[model samples]
Target: MDEMQLRSKIILTDRFDETFEQLKERFSEALFYHISADDFLVEHAKEVVDRAYLTSDREKVIVLSAKRFTPIAQNKLLKILEEPPSKTHFILMTSTKAGLLTTIRSRLPVVDMTSSKEEIQLTINLETLDLAQLFSFLQANRRIDAKEAALLTEALAKEAMRSGKYRLDEALLETFAESIRLLDMGSPPHFVLTRLCLKLLERKI
Candidate 1:
């Protein structure tokens, strides 16, 4: 490995250009493939990953900018991500992890952007939300995987803490933690979320 080679395969960043420039400087001889959102697809990933490296001496890097990778595309990429060709790397750039599948997010190491993170608005207030509202909310977020569910659980927990309406105690925190653990164990997203909500409802009682 060269002294200036990329230390990590996956980099999570909001400032795609800045990180990209740094990579270019580090791997000057490395082959670079820049794919925009419109250009990223399952076929594209297959084409790129299957091809032989242009330069054997240096690495090949694929930078996906502003692209929301579809589940199918990410799945197609999972094998190569786990085991890439001798000197190939992938850089995925996205504003948030919500759209990305849990499998992919877990694979990469996140890099902080130079700029502060943009605050994302909560679509529903979990504290005041009732059973009916919860179902409606879950309906809108259909087909989410276990990891995505865990992320959602963390977001809801944060919102609950900020709301100050519910009491945050050891039990509540433990339940939320368990929810995330269950997600990693292959539990269904809906079941895990629903169970977490029920446990949270206890705060009212």
Candidate 2:
């Protein structure tokens, strides 16, 4: 699914898979288990790029999703993302970007993804929910990092702008700026989101 993105400058989120489903038809599937640097001996760790543990660049990239491991393992995969081999592209599919270490998040660009039509329509068609509704979903979906939440929030803000009546972008920007501040202070996302929701609802009226 991602092979197409490799051809040029493209940021890949899970949606990339949809874009390349047909293109990747014949590409062999190569999967790998998460091997923590601490768990694998130094000697074995050095050999990880080899076939037994890791697949060659010609095959599909190593996918590290939130289901199998913690943020730490994704951090471990940073070495590969940092200095990717000629044909290797690593993909991380996690609900929360908050889980990833800052250094790791910095290395990757957030691919702006079009949220599901359900979400788009929900935000557009439904008039009951306000700006805070989107933030709530951002909180649940972006557990990995503040930046992930921020990225998705920002993307959705753009969507909000396109949707007609709400002053969503400004409301969101203000709310998230505070959210990031709390995040920097080591506050949990729920706490930060709570604060953000209050700010949003205050202005939503």
Candidate 3:
């Protein structure tokens, strides 16, 4: 087993297939149970764990990609996660680590695959965003959910800091970062965005 496969149980990755393929190469004899998106349920976790132990192979690998584990489901799998079969390995993949609980995160080492640059749709041109443009952008994105809001807030904060358009200092920058964290914790998107917009307006030079 590779050093990464030995230590990390959870992997936060964007290039899911690429990582899986690499694992397949390294552990060629390993039995792989790939549970993705919709297929990641409590029952599926049970099945995967059962199958993992059945193999008796030296290398047992389970790959989960973009699977949103509910609080209940996470609890159900906690035991298995805490103490899996000998020679068993798990790779939990997600676009963001926010969805996973701190309890689960504490048990696993994270392999962050998310890149530094925000997605194009999430990008904001801070230099050109006056009140009118900000309002227009908000109007266009009025229906975003908490996750989208979180991602947008992060991107916006980065743009604001990098552009230095508002001459944002550390305290103000931390406020923007806090807003992003709030969005991640399921804060109302409209309220979060509105407050962020108002703060940006106040500091706009």
Query: For candidate 1, lDDT tens digit of each residue in 1-205?
Result: 3323474444556567777888788778878787666325687667656653455667778777653455567778788777877877877775444345556767876564536533445567765778788778778766878757866876877777667777665467657656765776798898888788777776853
Tell me the lDDT of model 1 at 189.
92
lDDT of 3: 0.68
Q: Which candidate tops lDDT?
A: 3
In candidate 2, which residue ranges exceed 4 Å CA deviation?
A: 1-3, 7-23, 26-60, 67-69, 117-205
Q: Which sequence of candidate numbers ranks them by lDDT, best first? A: 3, 1, 2
- Sum up the clashes in candidate 1: 0
TM-scores, all models, native as reference? 0.54, 0.37, 0.58
lDDT per prediction? 0.67, 0.44, 0.68
For model 2, how does the per-residue alpha-carbon lDDT over 1-205 read when each residue is reduced to its tens digit?
4433532122334343453442344344533333222122334324434523443545445443331223344445557667766666554443333333445657865543435432222222223446656566545554546545445444444443445444443335445444554665687765665565455455442
lDDT of 1: 0.67
Full candidate order by TM-score, most accurate first = 3, 1, 2
Pairing residues by index, what is the TM-score of model 2?
0.37
